[model samples]
Target chain A: MIEVAGLTKRFGPTLAVSDVSFEVQKGEVLGFLGPNGAGKTTTMRVITGYLSPSEGRVRVAGYDVVEEPLEAKRRTGYLPEAPPVYPDMTVVEYLAFVARIKGVPRREIQTRIEEVSEKCAVTDVTDRQIGKLSKGYRQRVGLAQALIHNPEVLILDEPTAGLDPKQIIETRELIRGLAGQHTIVLSTHILPEVSKTCERVLVINQGKIVASGTPQELTHRLQGYETVLLTAEGPAAEMMERLQRVSGVNLVEPRDAADSRVTFEVHAEKGHDVRAELARAIVESRWKLLELKTSGLSLEDIFLQLTTKDLGEGPDTSDKSSVVGIV
Target chain B: MRNVIAVAGKELRAYFHSPIAYLVMTVYAALLGFFFYSFTATYVVQSFRIQAMGGGMGAPPMSLNEYIIRPLLAGVLTVVILLLVPLITMRLYAEEKRSGTIELLLTSPLTDLEVILGKFLGAMALYAVLVAMTFLYVGYLFLHGNPNAKPLLAQVLGLLLYGAALLALGMWFSTFTKNQIVAGVVAFAVFLLLFVMDWVTAYGSGRASDVISYLSLTKHFDNFAKGVIDLSDVVFYVSVVVLGIFLTARSVDALKGRA
Candidate 1:
């Protein structure tokens, strides 16, 4: 229900968001994964009609955000990085004000407030002033404000930034429950949040969309070769040599050895599964197999690799060619 | 219109929820009351002195409107409003920008005009309340003295318009910065300049001198103080009010681009 095309936002001479384009379909939960200062908030602000794009255009629910801002804004709900709340007002009072501005009918405002308060789990603090609430409650209140209008599109910038672990889980569950009814575009620096709650992920860095895919696809696409970790109580030098002889085994690197126990990272050719062959080879060699597991690239490693490549810093061991395909 | 009211209602609530509304009202009432007492005492003393002269000399008649209500509304209240209006209008946009609530208003479906007008009206409402307190003192005059109700009404109208023009200008200054203190200081400085702008006419006489005196905020109120509602005075205050609101709308619009 949202489309951003060639959206470039410039603050003075510095570009906050540059030539970025993405689409989120109806009822689809898209995770905007980026480290801090990755233009995630800037892009969301453009989509929500808070900040006009310096170049290009953004449309929400078929209304151009720049040309028909009121219509676009009517259908979009935004929760900025800092919750846009009046600290002096009570939670209920704040929600009621948001409901009014969002154009909820007078009679329906009460019901809508109660519904969102319950959904965001902020029902208990309804009567208390927002300034007195805990950070977690305030964040939830922000979430409730965004959901008050029940808009078709929800743009949340760092929705789970300040919540405790339990509160974070509850918020994720709440967002997951909102999937089919509302199109959500939530930005976060937390990698696991994307894998747990989002159907698709857009990884952004330095005002650019670095990568976009499902959690599994991102991992698989970035890792061009299969890798296996085998730990055995044997001589480290001999085990590395034996594993290197297995068919399809492209390379083997020893990781750690202590008290005659050894760890080896075995690399296999693409599309090859060398686990069975390596296991059989270890058994025939009379070495006791302690642990054997295939190790695919996790999202964390992929994120670090993707974000660190541009900085020309961090570990650069991965083949650069494999990453160029996804971008 | 509904959106405007909603924003204005929120602005009003913000003012009341904080200590600003009560503090300003109490301080303004105290100052105005003190001025009223001193002005009334002086008027009473002057009347007695004029009567003691036995109406023989060519001394002018001591009218209550001329001696008390005119200066109270036109001079004392104008200065009082000058001192207090920045307190009311400084927080209109500055606090919203400071606390990040501007995002909520800007991203909402409401137009920039609606938000600006709502804040304008909200500040005007509080100013009205401050002006309304003078009625408590003014009402007392009717019971004891034969003050001209026509001049009193005219002066009150003039005070509201005068305060409205300043409030609008203060609100416009508030849109420039996120710091309320800075907004208040700048607004007060500009108001002081406008208040004293006519003073420059004493030094020279030319087209520039006439323009400066005409632009002086207090000069236009002189007509209303004399019980005459000059159309030119009305138009001047209205123009300033409109200009202030228009500039505020543009500032808020530019904020979106820079935000």
Candidate 2:
């Protein structure tokens, strides 16, 4: 329920977001991945009507943010990178103040506050001063304030930053549960956050979106260049020769071994799955299979591959391939 | 309007929660009490003695303010009124920016006016409390001697007008910086300059001195304290309030990037 077109933001001479465009459909949890300073927060600000885009338009729930600010704001909830908080106000008071400012119906404000607090699980500390809250609780309070009005579109900037591992996991689950009721656009540098929490991923580099697709599609596209390792109780020389004989096996080489068990690493031809063929050959050779390892690329690998500048350019782009070289 | 009141209520509550309000109250009561006892009370006792000696007292010292109090105390109320006003007003938009809570407030459906008026009215309510306590001196002034009701009315009105001007100036200063210290210092500086303008103009050998004195807040506010309903003085305070509120709204818009 959100649309952004030709969106650009310039802070003086610096272009923070450049010609960015994307849509998050109703009920879709879109993960926005970018390195630090990649313009994600700028984009989120533009969409939320907090910062008017230097050019183009952003519409949320059918209302253009610039042309109809209040209506657009009425339909959207946004949590900026810093959990906007007043240290002197307690959590309940803070939520109530936010509810009133956000134009929630006066009569329903208390109920709305309770609803969001329960949903974000910030109810227990509703009476505590926000400044006294731990980082995680403060964050949950921020989420509660954003969701108090139950806006249709939610734009969260790094919703799970600076938390212990368990808290991070819990926050992700909470965001995931918010899907379907609220169209979400969440930005983070965490790769697995995208894989676990987003149905579709949008990879941003510098100030531009470099790629967008399902997680499986990204991995499948990069699967063209992959390899497998197979160790078996067979002659290294003959096993390597036979594996090379199999169609779609591109390269074969011996790996260090123990006793009669020898190892060989094999590269597959483009679009090839050589597992069945390799297994068949080992059974025929009467070679006892000791170990078979397939190169299963993690989301980190996919992120590195797409974010790696050289691979994106077919090696003609600037060398950010060191990103890929690591891990 | 709901947003404004909501904000105003919170700000009023904030004043009580912080010790600064109590501190301002203590200082305000002490200074006003000094003026009440030394000037208003002595004037009333003398007027009564003069009337006892068969002389006609001016207007029979009707309200507690007549013999002992004048609207000028109300005008100078702007001085101490200003002391507390800037500390809170400086934090209006400045604290929000410093704490990054401006994003939360502005990003909501609240309009700029709501934010501005809410904060203004909130500060006004606290100033109202300070003004309320100062009235106790008026009560005491009326108890012993005849006091004029009319001048007392003018003084109360003058207190409000002075408050409106200073509050506006203070709120406007708040918009200039994110640092509360800077905001408070700058606001205090602006008032200090205005407070000293008449003196500087008196010393210098140019019509510029006359011009500075004319622009000085003290000059515009002087008529109010003297029980004179000068429209120009009213206009001047109104202008100050408008200017302060206008600049504050613009600042919030600029920071919100809607400007």
lDDT for each residue of candidate 1 in B1-259, tens digit (9 for 90 to 100): 9989998898888889999999999988898889889989998887788788787278756788887788888889898889899999999999999999999999999999999999999999988999999989888888898788998888989999999999999999999999999999999999999999999899989999999999999999999999899999999999999999999999998987994
For model 2, residues B90-144, the per-residue Cα lDDT tens digits are 7877888888787887678878888889889998888888878866877765675
| C-alpha lDDT of residue A92 in model 1 | 96
- Which candidate leads the pack in DockQ? 1
Using all chains and alpha carbons, the TM-scores for the candidates as numbered come to: 0.94, 0.85
Candidate 1 lDDT, tens digit per residue, A1-327? 999899999999899998998888999999999899999998998898888899998999999999999999999989998999999999999999999999999999999999999998898889999999998899889989998999999998888887899989988998999999999999999999999999999999999998998898888787878889999987778888888889999889888888998989898888998899999999899998999999978889888988888777744455645665464
* Sliding window of 10 residues with minimal summed lDDT for model 1 chain A: A314-323
What candidate 2 gets wrong by more than 4 Å, as runs, is A229-268, A273-292, A308-327, B34-68, B71-76, B203-210
Clashes of each: 0, 9
Judge candidate 2 against the unseen true structure and give its global Cα lDDT, from 0 to 1: 0.80
Query: Residue A23, candidate 1: how far off, in angstroms?
Result: 1.4
Q: Which candidate comes out best when scored by TM-score?
A: 1
